[model samples]
Target chain A: MLTKRIIPCLDVKEGRTVKGVNFENIRDAGDPVELGSFYAQQGADELVFLDITATNEKRKTLRELVSRVARHINIPFTVGGGISSVEDVVALLQNGADKISVNTSAFKSPQLINELAKEFGSQCVVLAIDTRQEADGNWYVYLNGGRVKTEADCFRWAKEGVDRGAGEILLTSMNHDGTKKGFAVDITLQLASLSVPVIASGGGGTMEHFTDVFRQGKADAALAASIFHYKEIGIPALKQYLQQQGIVVRWESNENFIC
Target chain B: MNIVIIKYNAGNVQSVLYALERMGIAATVTDDHEKIRSADKVIFPGVGEASTAMQYLRERKLDQVLKDLHRPVLGICLGMQLMCAYSEENNTACIGIFEEKVRHFSAAHADVGQPAGEEPLKVPQIGWNNIFHLKTPLFRGVHENSYIYLVHSYYAALGEHTIATAHYGLDFSAALHKENFYGVQFHPEKSAAAGAQVIRNFIELVPAI
Candidate 1:
């Protein structure tokens, strides 16, 4: 049976992982590559590197960080944030990024999804949709790191993205992102109707939240950041908990560290 | 050791290069005919549309080079698909190194994700799954049920050349071997320890040419 994946998200700034990540044993705690290695050692099924470094020099640092992380870890990882063109996707894929996530650019040009999926195959293209529930109780698309709102509805955009050749959907609820209350199972379950594997992101608070996203949300994978970074939850422990609860997951033990 | 990874328009070549770097072996990723043929060990790794990838190889005259390689050749993912005779993907004619055909998963088995007498058809069998019925030196140190990463919409039907089989919609060749030529549908480079073992085994298979 194919096990549900537990992915840890890392925010990279200026080529290093942001603050508050458990870094006791790492020689250079700031390095994103080092953090990737640590998570790989802890049995993270896959890792997501979000380059949030807001600078004119974002390209050089993020590319270097991806290269370093690629050289250090063997597991697959996705690079997201500020990816606007096919050139950017090519550059990142050349740097050893298994997949590239597109959000704002994808919305700006829906045809970009078809172009990318045509050139690189759908498996390599992930449509990262950032959605937030408004006062009308209907989820709306947000762009520019959740600052700009778009008229596109979440469900319709996700369906159109898939039809445009997106193999996976990384749906994140902005309202639930920093809250950590729980995954937006309502939206996730609705998004799953698209039939291309949905990666439920944002508001992954506890182990129960993960199981809920998998069982009720019907998410093929769950991605979280702060929970895994703050040491409040360890990947190995969470996977074990899911396993005990009859949720299929891949868990590599300490003695068999691949790194 | 001169490890040459055949580089063309195919995607995911960088991951293979980095995998070798981690193994402490500097590998040259190139499409040079002489470089690919002369290298002691050749790794043909690919990711992309089969027809487009094969078209790129044909234009580069690599079609003949890959077919005539005398040394140990390892093909991963789409590289394995191209080693076959034909692929349903874009109806492409391949190098015929494996004497098999690549095909998209059957959608006949509907009601895929429910508990029924039949299983739903899942294409591109992404993520990690275990490979069993192992044979050949490629899987020497790999455990029978150990998981490896795979991401493909087409698969080569089981044949005499099959070295390992993995299940999704149905059992297909996870790894296939015919003489010096080896093909793995899964990405050993991205498959962690068990996958590392497979790469290590392939590198150690020959007694220095």
Candidate 2:
């Protein structure tokens, strides 16, 4: 059995880490390099850094930050935000980002995914989709920091993203964002129908929520921030709970614990 | 001495670097012929479509450089596949270091139980699987039925050079070992500390020069 992944997402703005409620009301978190090391030490499977600053100059700074973090952390890290060109993707990868996530750029020009995949290989490109449910109960895609609404169906875009050579889909639920209720199971199930691996994000309150997303929602991985950042749950204990529930995890050596 | 990782559009090189650091060895990533040739050990790791990956290697002239290296070299996943004579992935030719052909797992096994004549198994066999029939140096201190992580759609069928075996729809080659060149289908770096130990074995095998 393959082990399920537990991930923590950090939104980076002006070199500082921030967590927003429903992708708004950003509060100061801490320095990304320091927080990244902390999460890696606590046994995070992967870390995601979203550069929410939305400026060209900040872009350069973000790449440097990625390089600094990669110096110490031994786990995979993903960088997103204001990425509009292939050069941007290349810069991040060269600066130590294992994977690059594209949301707004992916929607603005669909060919961006195919082009980037062709240049950097599909496994290095991640299509991050942010979706919100409409009055008709259909999930509509949102872009540009979730300020623009598109007619693209969430499921359709996911299938298309994978078809365009996206190695993985980072599906975040705007409705569930910062709610702490749970993940969007319906959306997750729909995306999973495409045969491409999907990571469920938004609305993770507790460890049980994670297990539910894995078992009921059928997500390949779960990404959360407040839960891990606020010390509400530790990764080791969470893994223990998931293991008890019959979820396979890559367990580290307790006997080999260094210091 | 910095261990040089040959970066030719391969996957998991970063993870391999992290895995090396976890074991107290620092490595530098490079595709430069001189830098890689001068390193104590070189690792070639990859994931993704094979034909395109080979194209990238050839475009950078890494194909020729890899063949001429006298240092200890380890290839993982698609890295192992590229070391073969040829690959069925997109009907691509590869470095003929190992006389093997990478072939997709036949769908014939899916119909094993069906009326005596139907493709029975699935392609792109993903997830955790067990490997056995190990050789001395790589499988050293590891059990025969030790489980390893795998996420490949195609596999190198068992041949004279196979070092280990695993069953998907049937028994297939999980690893290949030849003179000076070692390869494994499963990622030892991503396989946890046990996997990390295999890397340690490879590091220890580095001729102490």
Candidate 3:
């Protein structure tokens, strides 16, 4: 069963929607193609934009705001800050973007994650780690966005970005980024114990912190940004409070509710 | 209903051409062989790497025009593992139009969510699971287990053109018909609203074929 995903990460700056508390103080959270088609009509199984103004004229308006949020959203979205090669992931997957997260040229050239998983393959490559924990618990690895710091070992560069192919692993936690006081559940269970698919990202505010980052950070996905950009929380009441706390999310329609 | 999304080199055909422009249906990604042989409906979406996507679908022969398309060809997710017939990932050879094979959910013996030392069930079986055994009409109104949106690492196992099924650590083949050729190891354009009612029941089966 693959349910536990409820992502919301929008970040984009200069074009719109922005949130940053521990990452700074930037605010304004709106209009990323209407808060990403209002979190894909509020079910939000996926969506992560983050192009914090990688300027070349705000990178052509974040590829026209990811082609108008992939033409007013259907679902599966992802696009990260200044992607850095494979023609910026084929211009944001030809202006639509399904997935393509790469943190700072993948830790400054880990062969740009095998040249974007050898040109868009490793399930459309995403290796967005941004750790930072130390004080003896050690986690280190942050780049351009988290503003540099790299001894590398954030579970050995996420097992060498999942051994150079990187199917997925968004993992944020710059000491619980934006500090809402929740996720980073022990390094998102140490990058979900490194098997692969682990999208935990920062301190999500509540909804029992996305059911403790998916039942104690076993996180197969649980990203957030200011608890869904200032609405504080409301991805259909946090997937109806993580489906009344069972946590198998992706719930919009009590029966076909798409819009 | 001209649709047409088979453009080879994988990677989610721009989210299945924005899930057919969010059902307003303005598709056409194209690999060209006569615009996908006079398309009436032909998705074959993907997310890549099956021996360089069958060497870019045999360098554009689009694998014999998607094995002589007579129309109605769904195929999402590595375009339903490159329309089966062989793919141990790089072991290649596909487009047999569903005789099945595509293994590697750790050899498909699958105990469903493997235990005895976790962390093994992650060979790309990516997001939203649960497709249950739903037999054809491309899952019309799709229910049984309903949760779609998959992202592979090679599957397809349960053959005889598996109508639909999904178990992650193993049950396999979540949707793969034969006749008018359809296939969906999930991602009915990122599964939401029961994957947009299986893309409006595959665009109302392109006006009932």
* Each candidate's fnat: 0.56, 0.06, 0.74
Error of 1 at B89 (Å): 0.2
- Over A1-259, each residue of candidate 2 has an lDDT whose tens digit, in order, gives 3457788888888888888888899788788888888887776777888887663343543778887877566556778888878898777776768678988878888899999878776657779999999999999999876778899999999989988978778999999988899999889977866655678999999889999898888887789987877778888888888988998765443525222
Instruction: Please give the lDDT score for candidate 1.
Output: 0.82
Rank list by DockQ: 1, 3, 2
lDDT of 3 by residue, A93-141 (tens): 8888878888767777888898788777777888988888889779888
Q: How would you encode candidate 2's per-residue C-alpha lDDT over B1-209 as one tens digit per residue? A: 65788877656466677678767898888899999888788788887778988999999999999888887788888999999999988999998888988887654344334334522332345435667888747666666666566767678878999988988766778888777778889877755444665677777753532
Interface RMSD, candidates in the order listed: 2.0, 4.4, 8.5
Q: Model 1 misses residue A156 by how many Å?
A: 0.8
Each prediction's TM-score versus the true structure: 0.92, 0.84, 0.34
Q: Model 1, range A1-259, lDDT digits (tens) per residue?
A: 5778888888776666663212112222256777788888787888898775432233432676788888888899898888877888888988889998888878989999999998889999999988989999999998766667898899999999999999899988887885678999999999877757889988887889999999999888999877777777899899999988998787645334233
- lDDT measured at residue A122 in model 1 versus the true structure, 0 to 100: 94
DockQ of 1: 0.58
**Residue A256 lDDT in model 3?**
42
DockQ, candidate 3, vs. native dimer: 0.27
Highest-scoring model, TM-score? 1
Give me the candidate number with maximum DockQ.
1
**DockQ of every candidate:** 0.58, 0.26, 0.27
Note the Cα lDDT for every prediction shown: 0.82, 0.78, 0.79
What's the CA RMSD for each of the models? Answer: 3.7, 4.2, 19.8
DockQ: the better of candidates 2 and 3:
3
